[model samples]
Target: MTIIEQYGWNTVWKDKWNGKYREHEGRDLLPGRIIGDFGSKFRVITETGETWGELAGRLRHTMTDSGEYPSVGDWVLLAVQDGGEHAVIHGVLPRSSVISRKAAGNTRDEQIVASNVDTLFLVSALNDDFNVRRMERYLIMAWNSGANPVILLTKADLCQDAELKIAEMERAAPGVPVHAVSALLGDGREALLPYIRSGQTVALTGSSGCGKSTMVNWLSGRMLQLTQDVREGDSRGRHTTTHRELFVLPEGGIIVDTPGMRELQLWEDEGGLDLAFGDISSLAAGCRYSDCSHEREEGCAVLQAVAEGVLEEKRLLNYRKTQRELLYQSSKEVKQKRKSAAAAVKAGSSRSRNSGWRKEMDEY
Candidate 1:
């Protein structure tokens, strides 16, 4: 197979790159896929095999933030140097799907977890780390990612009520496939093979100790990633996978495994929320008011459903909470943009005044 094909490249991506980046036409630059991303450097796999790459000085200068840099699943054009030991990245192809979240901590910055994923495995072990509320949040982000999200309930060997947990996950995420798999026991892994067909790419992500690494190891049939046991007191595992890396699966596909995330803050648009909570949104259509808040509102279908035991009140409450958080973040981003614009204008005006003063003094 061709190098690009091995990295999950297809005709659609080639068309997109050629149509948008016409400048690369007839150039000697080769196309490469980024499989590993360090803070300042990247590991790209091209026709020449794997090579370390760094952004060209010009590309680095143009990048306004880390979000613009090459991510693990990005397809980029590279200028090979030093006989294939190193390369310089020139451009990045448009992404088909992206999994991102608000960066951990106070910053409102968006951190891209993975890009160009065809399917996202939303894993949650059935052990102590399982929480329906957290699963709901992950589902919202997964919907926003533009990739098919398949919920995986791992560590089924440990949980006594695996079927019960799977049912709950199905309820929390309607219309999404939920598979209960034990990586250690090799159960339910074969069912996931269809999603990992040739030329396809899947990403595995979940909370720490949720068996994401174990899933990677099991699927790949080797110790590709190290797995540490969760603490006895608290089911949290150490960050065994410190960096994101893409692996070419023996089963004829690519899989990007990311470090377990402790917190999954939403950084998404309204459409994602609507799709993630389609059940609630469908019920909202039956509300008496066109703009019903669904909280203590008269004739609110959502509240009515909750009251009648048709819908879980916790789901409705979480939906509203996410909506409020999205609204607040959107407003905050707008204000920050306006403030930056004002500062730019003031800086320009001051520079102009100083230049005029300098010219007058020279004339005198």
Candidate 2:
């Protein structure tokens, strides 16, 4: 296989290039995968070799959303220049899967974590940072990402009840694979190997100081990333990974390591909430009222399940909380869209009036 093929390029991608990007081929444009995204620049790996790339002016101007720009793991068409040292990215291929979250702070924007990922490894340290509620939030984004979600309880050696934590996570994320791994001791790494075999792309994401960088170094069999100790008080590790990067393993497979997120706000939930909270959805189906809110409602199966100890009250509360967040986000997005539309109309009308005045002045 060629160099690009090892990075998950296949005949399907070639066919896509031929069908849509054929024109670029004649202009010395080549297909490359983005391995690193550093704000204004990108590190892309083509068959020729690795090169630094920046978006072409036209492509940059046309892309209005942050998610629309090239990110780590994106396949893009680029023109190599400066004797292969630099490149100009022309376009990005359609992504098979994308992981996104809300941009930090009060902004109604989407941040694309990674694109074209096949599997998402949600890592949480088994220390004080371990929170099942946080894991549930990650699961919602994972399910929405079009990638298979696998929970990785890291730093197992630090925790006395590693198995218990794994079981708890399993219960929280039904139908998803859960494993406890100690990167320090190299235990439980074997179970994760299958997901990182040749041509497979797996992304590791979790809160900062959760052992994602350690896992990357261990899996790559080298110190590909720097590791730091967590704070003694809070068990929170400093942000070891400052950016998202794609690394090709020595043996085979691919891994995308991302910086720990301080805040994980929901972006857009398209049935991800239901998938992440499958147990609650399943219980809700038996409610007498089809639209039962499960809060003080008669014949609410969900409430009954919680009361009878079949479901944890905390879990149900988290489900409701995430549901509310998604609803509120949706409303804000609708309002923003309307506001933008009105501004666009007003701007167009002003432009037309100005143009008419200019024409009248010229005729006069």
Best by lDDT: 2
Worst 10 residues of 1 by lDDT: 19-28
Show the lowest summed lDDT stretch of 10 residues, model 2: 58-67
For residues 227-299, could you state the per-residue lDDT of candidate 1 as single tens digits? 9999978788888899999998887889999999888888857478988899999999999999999998899
Which segments of candidate 1 are over 4 A away from where they belong? 19-27, 348-364
TM-score of each model, in listed order = 0.94, 0.96
lDDT of 2 by residue, 133-162 (tens): 999999999999999999999888889988
Q: Candidate 2: TM-score?
A: 0.96
lDDT of 2 at 64: 48
Q: List the residue pairs that clash in candidate 2.
A: none
Query: Scored by Cα lDDT, where does model 1 land?
Result: 0.88
How does candidate 2 score on lDDT? Answer: 0.91
Candidate 2 residue 225 Cα shift, in angstroms, is 0.5
Candidate 2 Cα misplacement greater than 4 A, ranges? 24-28, 358-364
Winner by TM-score: 2
